[model samples]
Target: MLPAAAGYDRGITVFSPDGRLYQVEYAIETVRRGTLALGIKSTDGVILAVEEKTRKLQISNVTQKIFQIDDHIGLAAAGYIPDARTQVDHARFFAQSNRLIYDEVVDVEGVAKNLADMAQQYTQYAGARPFGVALILAGVDKNGIGLYLTDPSGTYIGYDAVAIGAGSEQVTEHLEKNYRNDISLDKACVLAIESIFMVSEEKTGTKHIRLAVIDSKSKTLRMMPLEEIENYSKQVQDKESQS
Candidate 1:
């Protein structure tokens, strides 16, 4: 006997009898298989973090999951990262073009919408697979801090704090308990690390953590240094002991 999704699973454009898109669902499952990635919006700005496992001999300095889309916007991705790079390149071009034409920075929501629209297009066409990556986009703009999550099903939603990838459901529950809208940027950084550590295997060090921030004051994106990450890790440990 054939399964319910038998034929629908083979094509992005086909919908199952139950009105589900199997290819899109499969793409989302690819995101579930990735390492953890998350973002938090705080009173001061936004923080993005991800867990990355590396071989001992690997340099480990360069981050593979976090990317800068513009001076004020940063992205953290979980899933098929090659798809992420391709999307990032497209976003960079779109951002620069927006600046050139409007003589102003693009709105964070605009970029999110653009990517969501692009993702949607793939679902309506044939001969191409949906992007298997999910992205957390965070930025500081005139509207203040913005954070959005985009998935392979062509969905984009806003969030104060969100997580994606392996163990994300667990980490997300942690964020729900710990996240505060009034939290300071430094505190948000600590919270981001704490959430990652809750699910990360290399629990003791900052080596597997990749961090980035877009502060309201600066309205620019910057990578958090290892030294700062170590400090945040200590804070996470200290808070644990007290609680």
Candidate 2:
């Protein structure tokens, strides 16, 4: 009842009448997974930030895996963290497979497009309302610093910068005003956390936030801490006072 190649990436070698079992990893051993956010900068440098608490810290256990498929690309997002990880897992496998054939990091865009394709598939599995996930994918591809926000329903939005999750509205508003054609990584880092807070404050129910940046120079991903983000939040107040 299943194609011979169906679910090939997950190590399914045989065609079973029923679907195969998928093993979920424990969070504590992982890097940074769960309800989070991300930011990418393409200025003189690159930086990425993420909240340590993970999903408002309400859950007793959460993973801190910063889903980075390649050294050049990074991902931060929200909703169904495990599903997001699966998307990343697929991308990682593709990147590895491509490297074996072409011997490079593999095309970042191609990898992203493949991910978009999977997002739609993930949505279809849900009977109603659709099982969902959203992503702020950032990295340095062949053309250079690329940014995109992709949804679980197989739709994606390309951007120089983007935000996802509980504070997306607030973050989007901040981007409209402060996001210029180019800016320093330092400035972008501070702005990133503030946007998440802007929404967190309004909802009065948000806690964790994660951010990432893709450096145009070295093509690296940097994740920041909550304390560092809090410091930047205070600076915003100081700057506001001067203004």
Query: Which sections of candidate 2 miss by over 4 Å?
Result: 1-36, 45-65, 123-131, 202-209, 225-231
lDDT of 2 by residue, 142-203 (tens): 77667776664466667766655555556677788888767777788767666655655332
lDDT of each: 0.92, 0.59
lDDT of candidate 1 over 150-188, digit per residue (tens)? 999889999999999999999989888988779998999
After superposing candidate 1 on the true structure, give the runs of residues whose Cα lies further than 4 Å from its correct spot.
Answer: none
Report the Cα RMSD per candidate: 1.1, 9.4
Tell me the lDDT of candidate 1.
Answer: 0.92
